[model samples]
Target: MTNSPDILSNTFPDTPQRRLLLDFVADEADALQRGEQGGFWPDNHHLISPLIGKAGKFLDEDEHVAFFHHLLRLDHCPPVKTEEDFALLLRAYDGLGDLMSRGYPVCSLPFHLAVFLFGGDALARLPAEPEPTLASFQSGVSFLRYARSFAHMPGIMSKRQKFIDLSADRALVARVRKTLLHGHQQLLDGLGRLWLWAFVFLVLQVEEEAQPVIRKIREDAAAAGDVKRVETLERFIAAAGLAR
Candidate 1:
């Protein structure tokens, strides 16, 4: 497991390329916040693509860790102006997600934070009645599912719950519930249940509101003889002080 404090304190070596990329990220963020158009936006793909390609070529684990941390830190600037700006913010996250999905030895904490940050930005850029397309919702859910491997790690569960707390609105949560209910039956198994539980308990927050879905998941786990999953749901219910 990666030490959060160590990652936080780590910084990349001061090189011309590194300095240029960092400056571009800050400048682009400022330009976007000022609602400027067409200045360096067109150069984003050219500039960021090479960094993504070289991101994994660091000399050591410490360098690798610092690289990702630096990229994620760029997202701390002011809010973006357009979908293009949002896409720029997600470049590092998308690269990290791709790395993890390819079975790289990336730390789950940074990856999870990247996913959550990207998802928040993506949702913010959406219209009020955004379409429930797979692209629109899957990034957040997929990241939550991926983070399950580290669920037992300290602070992971609360972070998962916090992501739900931060990203969920009524329409988004309802759409997620509907998606999980209709065809994504696989999401109810194992750590997926934890994802569901977080959504139900943290996002939905009312026992009455959550009971039906919780009961269905519990019964499904029982029938499938998934004792661990059944216990997980029960513990969630008990934690919430909801009547069985």
Candidate 2:
């Protein structure tokens, strides 16, 4: 991600709200596609960070938090040109969630992938199924883990069931888990890097237009000894004409 203008924006066309939904979708898809092809896509991931920063800014200052809230929710999908496409994506996510909740097997793999990548609200409704493909299986495990963590994040007060051994398909879960635990670290790292790149762009831009919240992020990062956020903070400060 090179902080290119091509990746900027905060809303999908046709949606009621202004969100960088397309940029987000593009980044996530880049991660997965890169994982499949044995690499990373910096440009794809770089496209969304400013939007994330914008969402953060709006969340801090805008009275209409719903729009920004929705923007933050778009981490699941890669970028799309229109909200109509996003609506289809939403349906797939909801359908997949319902399928997972019913304890169906790998037949619902596409839906699972769609939901996790697209940030549709209905993922919690899906039943767990162990898809056989290398990508799907690994993604399934990661999805559950992330979902569990997301459930615990601030402002996400959903009562979805945590992923436990359902006993219905322990063998599959165990098999996929073993595989993912062994060689999937790169994928995770790539995803994190993608997000980091975007965050860098966000912090750099937002601090100039919206300072207070970015300052708070810096302070919190300092208190927590969160070295990883340093790059983002630096970019923001520099961009804001504050200091590196």
Candidate with best lDDT = 1
RMSD (Å) per prediction: 14.3, 20.2
lDDT of 1 by residue, 1-244 (tens): 1222232223656565555444454444444334332244245646655664354332234343334333443322213334433444345344433333222222223322333333322223222335333354345545455444444423344454554554445554544444333322343542453434555444334543465567667667777788877676666566555676
Candidate 1 to truth, TM: 0.38
Off by over 4 Å in 1: 1-129, 132-150, 153-168, 190-197
Which 10 consecutive residues of model 1 have the lowest summed lDDT?
A: 1-10
Q: Candidate 1 vs. truth: CA RMSD?
A: 14.3
Q: Which candidate number maximizes TM-score?
A: 1
Each candidate's lDDT (Cα)? 0.43, 0.34
The lDDT of model 1 is 0.43
